[model samples]
Target: MKAMIKVTLKNGVLDPQGKAIMGSLQSLGFNGYDNVRQGKYFELDIEAFSKEEAKARATDMCEQLLANTVIENYEIEIV
Candidate 1:
């Protein structure tokens, strides 16, 4: 089984890296972009009997290490 995970900061959190990227974009003459945010993506292959199991395992992984539950949110897609 394969799991695709996306981890992003929750609203109201400060993103200094995102701000720096936006500033660099503007300096490079890239216009019309209002804001930019950064996130994490992960692709994992694991042993699972079903799609549901894959998702469950992915969710567990996120809760344990992939994401910081207090400030980051995660989504899982199983294939």
Candidate 2:
């Protein structure tokens, strides 16, 4: 089974890296770059009988390590 996880900051959290990237883009003459935000993606291969099972395990992984539950939210996709 293959599981992909995307972790992103929740709304109202400060994102310095995203801000820096946006500034850099503007400096490079990329006009009107509306906004930018940063996040993380993970791809994992595991042994599981069903897609739901894989998603459940990946959710656990997100809660435990892949994401910060308080400030970040995660979504899992089974592929």
On the 0 to 100 scale, the lDDT of residue 37 in model 2 is: 86
Task: For model 1, name the residue pairs that clash.
Answer: none
lDDT of each prediction vs. the true structure?
A: 0.93, 0.91
Task: Please tell me which predicted candidate would have the highest TM-score against the true structure.
Answer: 1
Q: Candidate 1's error at 45, in angstroms?
A: 0.2
Off-target runs (Cα >4 Å) in candidate 2 are none
Worst 10 residues of 1 by lDDT: 30-39
Summarize candidate 1's per-residue lDDT along 36-73 as a digit string, tens digits.
98999999997999999889889999999999999999
| Candidate 2 lDDT tens digits, 1-79 | 8898999999899899999999999999898566588999999997899998888999999999999989999999998
